[model samples]
Target: MINKLSIVKLNPIIIREDRKNYIVEDRKNGEFYEMPNPAVDAINLINKGKPLGDIEQILKVKYPNEDIDIIDFANQLLDLELISEVNGELILKEVDQFGPTGFLWIPESVSRFFFNKYSYIFYISLLLFNIYILLTNHHLLPNYKDYFIFSWMSLNILLWLGIGGALLILHEFGHIIAMRANGLPTRLSIGHRLFFIALETDMAAAWKLPSGKRNVLYLGGLCFDMVAFACALSIQYFYPTGPALLLAIMKILVIDIFIRFIFQCGVYMKTDLYFVIENISGSYNLMENAHHYIKSKFKKEARKAGEAVYEEEKRTIKSYSVIYFIGVLLTILVFVFYSIPQIITTMSHSIDRLSSPLFSKPFFDGAIVLVQTLTGLSLLLYSWYKKYRLKKE
Candidate 1:
């Protein structure tokens, strides 16, 4: 016997009869709900106006899994008078793309592939080999002309730079591995950052994880670089002059390692150090909010007017912000101070070369410099524009 009244109360679409089970449909979401067979039989008996105790006995004999107190199920059925009860229900829904309103989501696939596995071994080996080459021949490594003759020149620079680029890719892989180890998702991509180079790993999900986990992921790449640097230093000190080329290579290797450390400190680019600072300050959305603030200033309008910004969303107005700002500023200041002097000196020499009759063909050199400068400037401007646009939205 089924309770037509209870079925009707649960939902208008639920129909009861002397059939196998009761079928309930959710009209709002266009979804279907199937009640447990025992429950359905009980409803069927009730619809036939049978005693509740008799229906319960029949249900008990047929479905052992439904042995729990009938009162619980009855209460749930009563509550569902406003709607239908569903278990493992299916409904078509739109995917959420905005990513939890304020937070970012790092895709799980990348984290699984890059971080949770030993895929980074390839990159580590490559870096180790390069370090070996540099330690073995420091002098010949930096002077690009030593290995290049006309035909070889075309391919050699690409090959060498390709190796360097590969190490950078591996560096990002280190971050990914760290993130995955700490139960965070991450994705790696190669792009340009101003006049410099860039390899980015999206560890946005790390914000949801604990601070220690976040720090491990953030510092993993630098840790790898530091280890390589230490090995190179050890070789230099122990072996002294292994070979002329090896020594030269080591010098160049050390220079590159040092430069990478410098680049890692580039907070304006939202590098590892930037994220670490954000994590330390308990402001997961600091960078995003700062960027938003900067964009709003440019637009002369309040982008998120009347909306209360979380402490995590506040920019470097407080102590943490000021500290990170100053650290990044000082890093940039030192880089500029060292680089500008060298660049000026290089330009003066290039100009002198342009004036000399013997080296009058300055077109190639000028083109190279122009291309490098333009490429760098374009990347910087584009990155800034992207940040501004993202914050504005």
Candidate 2:
């Protein structure tokens, strides 16, 4: 039995279902939103206060050919704040703003054609290329020192590094593929942390899709990285003598992949993980708005010198204290503990290399080290600037 009061508490989307298409009307604005068949049905069922299980059963009965996971579908709806649960009763919630609708511009035809046609082949080619490199360079494994020395002076090092960077772009594309597969539009762009890295795909649209789709998008990048790692591992297994050289390359690849996953996928900083947390918290823009609200408090205090403003500030402060504390703690852990140690160790190693006699070709080695250091420093400065801007905003 449905709770009528809870159902009444929700603002429902008025959906007109036709054989060909489904149209959703925004009750407040009197604007109609058009969507394909399945999404229309899902939205209607949710609005009717149908339990997720019952809705899935209905969808399965009507569209027997379509494979839909009810739980995942339900979670997606929940994440978008289109539905809510009140005392175990499912209810619909009307969203005032739909966030950015840029995802709507991506055509389904383009998504289907590009992803379905190219993803598998792209992944396979990448794996094979890495394997080929390992095999060809097997003899050069024992002379890793020589290769490193040559790499310092060789223009080919830039070419090989470019190839490595391109592979990372493909890795981001894998994420876009999975997101598109789930009927979500994604924005792909180049993002720099401290160094100009490969590319990044914004799967923020995935949050509006079903939970299963979000999982695919989140895990897809890691899956591609794992595939590349597996191929590298296979090369190492077949050619054991060049283990050290292979291992070093593998370490760089794995670390880069893992760091991106942690920072971009981890939820604490409003990346993919943040979306997941929003889903779990039943607060769509909790972190985003919470940060804004906290900033507003400070602004209010600065602008209005009144006890009322101070009291309001205290209330907003109290509302987000726990979350803010956790964020600060995590920042300390990552920066002071993890990143600081890595930066110190890298600096120490670079200084030691600069002074070491191993750099017989002083000019070449010094230049290589200098270039690497400068690039690293530039990236660090850029990241700090970006963070500062984000905080200011």
Candidate 3:
């Protein structure tokens, strides 16, 4: 319904400049779009109350060589729900905000208290203390036996699951608080990264801030993990003669923290550390570009990654491609050498235990493991459905 003389009324929007594109976000529902220079110019003119025809003429003059289609651009804006009205008639589409809402009450001061320079110094010092503690007392280092803290395998599995679930909440809380401190709201939800189920913070709004300012949001979870690790080590060091169960719990936490830290290094999974690297390197599409680079190596005519960007991005993409390939290869190797064998051995043991008399210790143990396995698979499937299938529909 847009014509040359149509005066477009745009919905309220917050526009911020990214490195090469402008981010146009609807203020009400938080929907955003990344637009290049020309499109952004049209938007700016629209904001200034220019008629669609005048905006088209201005853009045509700005880019004389390119085909400037004002009607097409206006239609695209309409599709995005950016256009509230044309010729003063309401054409706005109401949209619900994406993700879980209601963290607006969290004050920025709380974030500053937790994430300031002095707090980071304390965290770094604590991490160093932990390293010293481990080095001096080699027995403090993580051991596989730590996983079997309880007498019953089922109890031990449940213990880890309970503790891990709690810690995961803490980890995600770090992200939420950091985002809130920056005056941005975020929500946590289940997501799948490859074969793993992960809790993710929807911080897409963080892009409104400068890349340098956003690193803290990415590092927030890992920071909490580091602090948790240090606290566990400190408890073990100071309370040598503490209650037996408390000491055992600390030992379990120590190993869990170690595993969590190592797991975050899995850049292929887009873990916290991956975002840190991405922010530092300014490789906004590192994973996608790396994928393209890897694909190009196998097929000659494959679309090259980072061809249009600066040389620095190209280098980051090339370097990450190598890391991505090795990471994936190592994952496959681990699955073949460790995970598969472990799953098979656990299943075999569970089957033997299940053959025992009803209500016996062995039967209960096997039943617990089976339940845990099924629960894990169910969660994985649910995560996949939520992330991909549900989104598509």
Query: Each prediction's Cα RMSD?
Result: 15.5, 14.6, 3.1
Q: How many backbone clashes does candidate 1 have?
A: 30
Structure candidate 2, residue pairs in collision: 194-379, 267-273, 267-274
Between candidates 2 and 3, name the one with more favorable TM-score: 3
Tens digits of per-residue lDDT, candidate 3, 259-324, equal: 666666668888787888777776667887777766776876664433534355667787776777
- lDDT (Cα, tens digit) per residue for candidate 2, span 1-393: 332222212235666543235545544333334456777777667667766667777888899998867666555545545454544665655556443234555566665654553665765576676556556755422221222323343232453355467667767766765666667656765445434444567765554444433555665665577576655455555666665756556544543443454455334455555555444443444665565555665787543543433443444344444655565565555555445665565445455556757636644555575686577567667666766887896
Give lDDT: candidate 3, residue 341: 61
Colliding residue pairs in candidate 3:
none
Error of 2 at 45 (Å): 21
TM-score of model 2 (CA atoms):
0.46
Q: Which residue runs does candidate 1 get wrong by more than 4 Å?
A: 1-167, 182-185, 191-195, 266-269, 287-317, 354-366, 375-393
Among all windows of 10 consecutive residues in model 2, the one with the lowest summed lDDT is 140-149
Positional deviation of 382 in candidate 3, in angstroms?
A: 1.3
Better model by lDDT: candidate 1 vs candidate 3: 3
Residue 131, candidate 2: Cα error in Å is 23
Which one is best on TM-score? 3
